[model samples]
Target: MSAELDPRLLTRAREVVSSITGFRDDAIANEAMERVVRGELARGRSSADLLGEMLFPQSTLSGTLVRAALVGETYFFRQPEHFRYLSQVGVPAALRRGSLALRGWSAGCATGEEAYSLAAALQASVPHGFPVEVLGTDLHEASLETARRASYGTWSRRESAPRLFPLYLDGVDRQVTILPVVRRITSFAQSNLLAPLPERFGRFDFIFCRNVLTYFSLSAREAAIALLARALNPGGLLFLGAVEADRVPAGMVREGTPELQTFRLLGPGESASPTPVPRFVERAAPPAPLIRRPMATPVPVRAQVTPPPPPARLHLEALERIEGGDVDGASAVLESLVRQAPDYLPGLLELALLRERSGAREAAVPLMRALRMRAERLPPDQLVDGPEALPARFYQASADAYLNLGALE
Candidate 1:
């Protein structure tokens, strides 16, 4: 806390912020609030003086706080993979769906960088004569103005950022302008993600709403995601941040691998949502698991690749990745999780099976041994803690089969 910061003023600011942003953490939301308070105080505005003024939703004070709170640093092509996927996978699929034109959105576009980036990607990827449009939106008015200008300072250009396509014009002092071509296809607006985009905005082929949700409360995040999903056309894709993949959107099926964190709205003739992965739960054993590996010759032991549910978030994420076929990525997650919480039963079991599957049965032995040791100490009927709440024996049987160590008599 800054010694000069006033607690009463901070409290008032927090209330206004919570009412508006639904930000999950006060400290993060407080960042802009503290600055606003400091600025007001330096200008001879007392804490009472500021509080005395109307700070309602439409008040000047409230607007100032929101602009400050929403201002975030961004650069061109921040996450290139989304662009690559858009150009390659997304474009063709939408084309196949017979999209007359492609629509894209950069939700919570902090500055014009992402919006312009989307414009460039769509312009380059979409076929000629098709109308392509991108709408970049944020609550920060000044940032939107900067985006509308379509000019950027050097800060917007990070050396490591991938330029999958040309973004800006090559100029000197007056240089660094977004190509007139890109500017033509892109537009910026000051808009709130918490609210539904107007009907005029129309449904989109894909939407990129990354990282911004990290600032939102649980309910707010869900609302924002649902709104974004609704904005997508049937077969349209919604792209979220990598860390934001934990919550699968309602009625949307997971697309690509866990790495992609993309979801597709069910198109015509597509099966309805059966996103069975993220909602790890305790359920009766399915008639068949995901994969049943070869049994040990003598006793014909079987190892089920699908996880028994009721796992921690980390484990669920790994399982989701595995379900998406990112084996190495899942292994990395499981290894770290098991190492940190060595006694975590689901981690031990799932990671062991992965290690065994990857031809590292040598490494798998110790994990299997550790898993068996742990599960044996627990009563077979006692369910382990996880979304699925599978019994200890479920893990023990898996471990025993991998080790070819025959189940306990």
Candidate 2:
């Protein structure tokens, strides 16, 4: 088998993928393409024959390439604040329209976490027996099968609150499954975002397409947004990733704070309105002291008591526990250290990875964000003092976390 892939073969693979999925060549890295080429060669297929299958409109090879190249990384309650707003604001608004039925769509719903999250939110918001329907669509059949199963591991629950686990999920032997109530309202299907959505899918009152458009080419992004806008009911809401807020299409007005990353479709004869600024209640300052207390005569101060050990010590202790395979104990110690020093890079990265493994990736975001902010403020030379400091490793870990969460550009 040839280790070298022909440039023409790579170009053909890219074109086939782009035409089918609207992903650019750069979006699917060369490494992934090489893997596909090598796999075909290992199976005794020549490069020319593999290319022919890829270029064929209905060939299974094209679908295989799409699945292999496009990664689906999602967890439950990813960006919980989005679900909070959906429950508090979006659901209420849709219910207010006096329609007996409420419909929501999770486009590009990888493995059904986001779709199930939306269903859970709506279930919590609406009264019993209210007609609520949630549709989750993705391009990969394998992911759709996973969505249908509704069973997930710690990786899926990392960001999910413990309380929510008992409320909405059934956990047994380290696998947590979405409950029947959530599954009842949600359905999954194989569909491509670049292609025309099925007519039976119908219009939706709310649509979630987060962290997906960033992978698309500009023209593909525009086309997908247009299709989404057309699929939305008048005054319906669309939730996008924060990074994509600026690219919302015409006839749709951004709603809520920029942080919410929500957009609403404007009906005929309607004009876009500025999102209302949130009003925070100001707590009154405690009543001023009647008078400034005069300084007391200082007695000889007692020798200062010894201070507690620094967070770095606790971090080191946690590392020992982790090395010893007491992950739970190590996590407990790391959690305490981070609470005391949220910006401690070493502990922060360790804890974030722990949270990720435990199915709480969303919970890890702020810690990673803090680390990123700190790294950005300081130069490499100023980032560390010793091997244990590991500032460069910290920065790299932060970058990796952001990439995992789809927060990095």
Candidate 3:
């Protein structure tokens, strides 16, 4: 139809479409906006009504445009290799190092597909007895709600490894529900990376901040990365999107075989606890206590919390497996850690690297992406360089790996 809409209205519509979708093309954005406007008109809504319904939540006329802008498209296991790496290398290393009590943050988790995938993988990989805690955060309340519910459709499963499906999800009526086993180990919460983290959540060993960084401007990306660096522990690993990984600041190790790029968290002198403090209490005002105890009731006090015993020996065993070339056996241990504590980024990074080496690239990408997304909000000082850079021999090996993957193209 001939143009009849107000010039300002058309401009607002185009801007909303572009901002939401991260599409810079004016023509395509305009077309998308036109379609939306036409659909609203067909539903017998006035221009103002369409604008109100679609855009007007954040502010009045101007704010509504921003509200209407949202880009949401995702699926479970969208990137497979990243998960493989987590299962094989990252998880095992974290477990061996006795970082079972891990804090995992899924930054901009979207609809929670990746977070759920992590939970499922850990559940399938862990040995008979261990506990794991996982938490996912998203800025969009709607996305957080979807993640909390943990429900998906057939499309979410389209790219999932068929063999692992039964181990993770309950597929019914074309809808896949996260199994109870997965849910028991994972939880979802809402958060914004731009602000200070919620008091309830602290430093995390593993952080998944994938794909989301590409959507932000460079300044925001840098700020987010700095925050993520701070959020991680020394030697804690970071995963990133394939495209985003190279963009990460120097100081963090950026090496993985095929599907993943991992940034290593340097340790204190190569031999220190992954989590230096076992029971770190946040700085806050003390809670009010009861002044009088009833005859049957005793005054409440903080429980005595003990740190778990170190797993240095288990870590040695993992190294033995690596030396013996029993990568799968090593992976078994790593998977256990992920199952018991999937938030440990170092373990996830190690596992992702192993998977890439073992030709499981399809399974490593997600872990890398997840880590990348999480690292975006970490503190920048975490990227400080260590004295030892990669050896010359390792660079040669890396070149060969790149050539094998046809990445030179």
Q: Which is the leading candidate under TM-score?
A: 2
Model 2, position 84, has a per-residue lDDT of 67
Question: Which prediction has more favorable TM-score, 1 or 3?
Answer: 1
Give one digit per residue, the lDDT tens place, for model 1 in 238-318.
Answer: 998643445468878886545567898987687764544322211223333246678766543585555543348788788
TM-score for candidate 2, please give it.
Answer: 0.69
How displaced is residue 118 in candidate 2, in Å? 0.5
lDDT of 2 by residue, 267-335 (tens): 889887775633221223333444668879655579666665587778767766654446677777888
lDDT of 3 by residue, 279-378 (tens): 1111123334536665695545786655532343333354456544466677776666545544444444556666665667666656655444443343
Superposed by TM-score, candidate 2 places the C-alpha of residue 127 at a distance from the truth, in angstroms, of 1.9
In model 2, what are the clashing residue pairs, if there are any?
154-359, 157-359, 158-359, 158-360, 159-359, 159-360, 159-361
On the 0 to 100 scale, the lDDT of residue 254 in model 1 is: 81
Residue-pair clashes per prediction, in order, are: 9, 7, 56
**Local distance difference test values of all predictions, in order:** 0.74, 0.71, 0.54
